[model samples]
Target: MPFIDIKVIAGVFTPEEKQKMVEEVSEAVIAVEGEALRPVTHVVITETPSGAWAIGGKALTAEDVQTKRAA
Candidate 1:
């Protein structure tokens, strides 16, 4: 069985949209893997918010950039 893991910004996507995305991704994987093998046994999706997301200890947010631009 093929195991696939997918990650995306959680707060940006609705629950329904997430489900559909997962389904489509899994189907594509299965198509490539072939029906003989079991479908993807595991699927993982992770979501993160822009505010909480950080790079090099600096929290990144759209508002932060917008404020800088306004200055």
Candidate 2:
């Protein structure tokens, strides 16, 4: 069994996008660990409220994450 935990800034990703991520991530794990683990694999996505996530001592918001992704 494998556990994949992901966290992103709140409002940064849509529900559809998250589902896509889950699918692709599961496939990737299956490819490595074998298909038998598919049912046991877990991919968890969590969101941190704006200003609740930080890096380098500075809190970051959804806009900050979007801007960084665009760069």
Candidate 3:
């Protein structure tokens, strides 16, 4: 059996979008592996506040990008 796990940041995708993504991912997995017993796939989405996530130790937000562009 093949097991797949996908983790993505929350809020970026809606429930319906998430479902579609999961389905597509599962199908891709099946395609790679021949039709055997059964395959297991898991998708985990996590949500974080604007300041909770950071890159290079600096938090990034929509406003930050806009401000940088304006400057």
User: Largest lDDT belongs to which candidate?
Assistant: 2
Write down the lDDT of every candidate, Cα atoms only.
0.68, 0.93, 0.62
Please give, for residues 33-56, the per-residue lDDT of candidate 3 as tens digits.
755623454444555555566789
Q: For this target, which candidate reaches the highest TM-score against the unseen true structure?
A: 2
lDDT of 1 by residue, 1-71 (tens): 77777765445556897789778877787777876754445677776666787779998675664566569
**Candidate 3: which stretches are off by over 4 Å?**
37-39, 46-50, 60-71
Question: Which 10 successive residues of model 2 have the least lDDT summed?
Answer: 5-14
Q: How accurate is candidate 3 locally (lDDT)?
A: 0.62
Model 1, stretches more than 4 Å misplaced? 52-71
**Candidate 2 lDDT, 7-66, residue by residue in tens:** 888988989989999999999999999989999999999889999998999999999988
Rank candidates by lDDT, best first: 2, 1, 3
The local lDDT score (0 to 100) that residue 42 gets in candidate 3 is: 48
lDDT for residue 14 in candidate 1, whole number 0-100: 67
Clashing residue pairs in candidate 1 (N, C-alpha, C atoms within 3 angstroms): 10-47
Specify the poorest-scoring 10-residue window by lDDT in model 3: 37-46
- Alpha-carbon RMSD to native, per candidate: 5.6, 1.0, 5.0
lDDT of 3 at 65: 48
Error of 3 at 60 (Å): 4.4
